[model samples]
Target: MNIRADIFSRLSRTDAHLFYLPPCPTPPFHSPPPQKRSPLHSRDKSKEKNVLITGTSLNGIGFESARVIAKHANLVIMTGHNSDRLNLAADTIKRELPSANIRPLILDLSSLDAVRKAAGEVNAFPEPLHVLIHNAAAPIGPFKLTVDNLESQVATDHICPFLFTKLVAPKILSARTEHYTPRVIFVSSIGHGIGTGVNFDTLGRPDPTRYVPMEAYYQAKSANVLTAIELSKRSKGQINAYSLHPGGIYTNIMNPASAPKEAVEGLHKLGLLEADGTPRKDATLKTMGQGAATTLVAAFDPRLDDKSGAYLNDCVAANELIGPPSSDPANAERLWNLTEQIIGETFTF
Candidate 1:
């Protein structure tokens, strides 16, 4: 299953740009000012639109998303906990697109203080931030506490990102114009379907007596969806907030060495990897490019203007069977309140 070849085969049949461009032109809901131009324009105002993506390692979705979005976005900020990998990913993108304006920022999602400092640096950037992609996450073996005294998974996947988003909300809002709406994209997972809902009593700390590694991961993913929903509602359409399940790709998140055997086998059976268990480098499995497709769409798709809070899978709106739990208003609000309490700061939109 040569997935990359298949994608290229499909792309060979049409204008390759079709893969990245929006399906159709979607006019802004509001009329633009006389001199205001759409950010989608290739020249002038388009340079004002900047996008930030976290967790950008060499073969992950964040790196791929940055590569694709950099084709049009004026500036793409690629962030990660590792400085070397972050710079390397940015350099790789630059090699492919010499005109690309990609910058590297250090962001360790497990630490609230680090998130705050990163947000401060982002705020200081000369260009306004038009899009933020929270693409970094990990599934560890045990429930370890972070420096913030919270479960590592939830802290990285939800809490730190929640705080980062809140701190950067003003910058996101300030980037808005009649021609553009700032967007926040959460790179959630289909594992969210396994989650019941957030447990308010044991948010930062799971009950030690009844801890499950996968369950914790699912809960954090669900929290991602709920946070996006609550942020969208709180923003009153002023900002677009979305979460997505990037199609199963054989990335480090699912490395065979660290992941469960069954999980790895399932990925192999799904044609995302080879029999030897390495990610299928060919086009058969969903390539990193394919995994990043939905994130790119959710970030720039104009048709989503009225669909802020929507959960997307496979580059489109996910059905109720896989997406309903994350849509519960009560759960969203509950998580938002609990998050505010955990962070010791209330976010007012």
Candidate 2:
């Protein structure tokens, strides 16, 4: 497929550009080129490092991150809501790397209690955690509330992850050494530019009348950026926290069944999807490996050691394109305080 032509045609036709596809060129799916790894990663012994990743569906970014990190991480914990799928992902990774150490932990980020329980279990583990990757997120779904009565998107995207991070922070801190730097990576989206900003007053209140699925998604993603920024500040160089747009990949997050028929058809009309609705095996859409590049770089790159809290895109710091709103310190502080209030915990640091 002619990716450049398809994106251009789509851009010319659509006035509402809420969906995020990176403008950068992508390699074809069948032969995705290898990405560069951090030199620092080669010096580390896999058995000495511990990593955790959320939302590890078989073909998603999280799963890909785990697959790549497995070669360097001693123990990689992959978490998801379904035990069956998590086990399958673990098996798939094992098939490729026979000696890979990976474990599956069930966690529904939409539920606060589940997040807390999962965090507790992880915290009890003796190993010091060196990496935390919040790669799980939902697409625009029907408006609903969790047991905590908070909007599902915000809860899954921000609230629960925030709580889980707080609960497991001590372990992350303990893992840090002069040679090892603990890292936190949040997989955000360029769609964050579409949000109208966080509304603290109506944050958790579920109002069907006021719910706009795309806006809700955008707000939650924006909160991810804010969370990473604030978390980096609080860590004060002890940990590196970064948020990034993982390029436009055709994962389950972009499932046609969950989108408006017109939008789906529009994407299909462009050469982005096949007749069967899967992403075309062309340069138009990124393969899972391509989408996971920025995340892998953020996790292990030594060059990024002092660039904590930066928003990355296309595998480099991209605060300029993400715009001022994402970097606004005021918004980060506000979101941090609001998250603490909602989670009912104080992270003093």
TM-score of candidate 2 versus the correct structure, residues matched by position: 0.82
Model 2: per-residue lDDT, tens digit, 41-75? Answer: 13333345798999998868888888877876789
Model 2 Cα shift for residue 260 (angstroms):
8.1
Tens digits of per-residue lDDT, candidate 1, 1-349, equal: 2322223223212212124334432211122222222223222223457989989988687887777777777899999998998889999989988998988999998888898999999988878889999999865456578888888788899999999999988888988889788999999988788668666778965566666666777788899999888898999988999998876766875687767664566456556666666877753345566667678768876767788988887566664645466678988998999899989999987
Q: Which pairs of residues have clashing backbones in candidate 1?
A: 1-284, 2-283, 2-284, 3-282, 3-283, 3-284, 4-283
Supply candidate 2's per-residue lDDT for 228: 90
lDDT for position 121 in model 1: 95
Quote the lDDT for 54 in model 2: 94
Task: Give the winner by lDDT.
Answer: 2
- lDDT, residue 203, candidate 2: 78
* Candidate 2: residue 192 Cα off by (Å): 0.9
Residue 100 of model 1, lDDT score? 89
